[model samples]
Target: MHFTSVQCVQGENFLFLVNNADDESSFTYEEKSGKGPRSWGEINPHWQACKNGTLQSPIDLLDQRVQVLSHLGRLNRDYKPAPATVKNRGHDITVMWKGEAGEIKINGTEYKLLQCHWHSPSEHTINGTRYELELHLVHKCSQGNLAVVSIVYKYGRPDRMLSKVRRQICGIDEQLFHHIKSVDPKQDKELGIVNPGDIKFGSSRKYYRYLGSLTVPPCTEGVIWTIVQKVRTVSKEQVRALREAVHDGFEANARPIQPLDGRPVYQYP
Candidate 1:
């Protein structure tokens, strides 16, 4: 069973906090991942200290009436994208996944869906339990406001998107990863967007809404988080595709949850 506890604490990501904000605390950058030279979300030795430390995000689930704002009605004013493009975010890791998609509208803002990546052992740990996988739907507004739709995976069935994602990358498993010399997330297959463009949205009315940081460091806060209570199921074959992707490490892609600092996590009214 996988449970995700998300908090909507409004503010910029913590990386900005440690750098720009004046009120710094041990919560800012004392963790392991914070000290490493890793890129925005990639793993590094720094994560070890972070896992042991407390100050993290996706805090406890709080019961309250969160204001349900209308989806942004901003349309893609100008959009022309490839099926997939690789982003060398400077962490020695290149994201060769999906591309900017002209779909999924919300709150007056028409956002473009970028690449979707997988996480093993899940990212959001609810109460104290974790899940098998998590899919991050990365979206960007024309103005540059970043919004992420986080979907947790439950194994036993194959999810179509997950299956397609696995076929894109080469080595997604540990034994094969450790057993082999090297694996390239960009080589040996497709490097493009692979999710359905016409999947219906607003299919569920229940969602946990919050303002939280990126689960991974530099643990930025102030991101608008919407964890849908209703999860879509995928085929078991789909789950294998993702499970076989990383196949290395102890499924350590998820970041530690930060302290709520008295923030409110609300369910849609």
Candidate 2:
């Protein structure tokens, strides 16, 4: 249903060009000037959802407010070790799955794994305290529905998955800046084969669920947010490597916490 123009074709590589010159999707995380989240509505009139949307994300998870629901069914995550590439998207480092590799089932709808990204200082906070990092595993169903699982990371031991990604990123001195830099492990590359399940969730499978929008622009509001309660640990060196991977002057790429605005947050046991 959706078609994109092939901008560049070289041997077997094809590049699809997306026209987002006038949208907030082109904006950065700078909070002071007109290019920030606060001015997204005025800058890009088309993506007014960024400012006016009620169900926005990166909310402060207040435990006293959530309703504990033990009857909610468990989410099925069928992720396999797949070939992936890492991209420095100006704001964050993202690991993208190559092809039809894995899928996750939520509420009976199966959403396939697309890509995973991180936010330094974390996007979601627990009771007003932010973690060292947050990893978002994004999935999409064939019907265009999105379901994101949020993993919180603290500083302690080295994380295997993160260490692998950090090793590849540590060598690159230049910033891609709106471009994707590939990491091919098969060719003895930087990134390694990472199973989605390898991401630590600690001892609890419990989480806080809510209906919310994307943290960034074009902030579509149908996204199902699954915020894990357990926190994992990663080494200080790993965190340092990730910080170095960011574009200049944009060290912290996390969006500010949004107001919950009376939305019901459920705790699934």
Candidate 3:
């Protein structure tokens, strides 16, 4: 199915649209395959943006190029506990909120929380240095635009939110293996009530903001990206658990850093 032709109804489940737009089994992280990231646009007509989009994401935040702007302000969020589920999507582990999980405000526009997923070795790098993990808090406004808040983690103390759902993450891997061995469809494990606030944003209110596209295929553009300035800590085991949870060939799922393309990167004070 072509993603560009998919009609998005206001307040509809954006995650559902994303999951169905492209088949996960059709492409892979391995570069040797013809269906890898570099060839995503050719694999399907709907994903031409993957190769042609000028505002692609996962760019390296070079310190020499950022413009510090205090007026950009702190990230304003009003999150709450919501019924959620954890799923191993073969490519990554995602925690999906099944109810109103609250929203984040940017430039006076409110974007409702949708879902968050993890990527190993961090998709966005700082001054060319990649971290151990990256967490993307996905949100969508009523107008169907997306705004993502990304938190990159280094190796040290365990992450608070990941620690909370460690057991569930392990179970997801087990279920995924079972499903792969059988003919049953994939399933999401109920994570009960999960509070988005538990995922800390660190002490610094500073962040780098820019416009970019989805790192995954379809590679939709115009996503508002807010990357936290502070690099938090996570245990080695935590990173290992996440990497092992996904199927093979996706263990290192971070996309190669895209060119800045002369886009201005703003840093908030």
lDDT of 2 by residue, 1-269 (tens): 10011111121100111111233235767766557778766676766877898888889999887888776656567888777667655556678777665987776668788888878879999888899989988877665567789988899887767755544555454433212234321222335466766777766687888877778766666677889888888776666656665562336777888888888888878
- Tens-place lDDT per residue, model 1, 70-156, is 342222223344465332121112233354555444455555555445555556654455666666655555554455666665655
Candidate 3 lDDT over residue span 59-175, tens digit each:
999999898888778899999999997777777778889999999988778889989988898999999899999999998888787888999999998888887775444545442
lDDT at position 107, candidate 1:
55
lDDT of 2: 0.68
| Candidate achieving higher TM-score, 1 or 3 | 3
The 0-to-1 C-alpha lDDT of every candidate, in the order given, reads: 0.44, 0.68, 0.79
Scored against the true structure, residue 54 in model 1 reaches a CA lDDT of 33
Ranking by TM-score: 3, 2, 1
Ranking by lDDT: 3, 2, 1
Candidate 2 C-alpha error for residue 207, in Å: 0.7
Best by lDDT: 3
Q: Which stretches of candidate 1 lie over 4 Å from their true place?
A: 1-56, 62-82, 85-99, 126-129, 167-189, 198-202, 233-244
* Candidate 1, position 73, lDDT: 20
- Indicate the worst ten consecutive residues by lDDT in candidate 3: 176-185
Error at 266, model 2, angstroms? 0.5
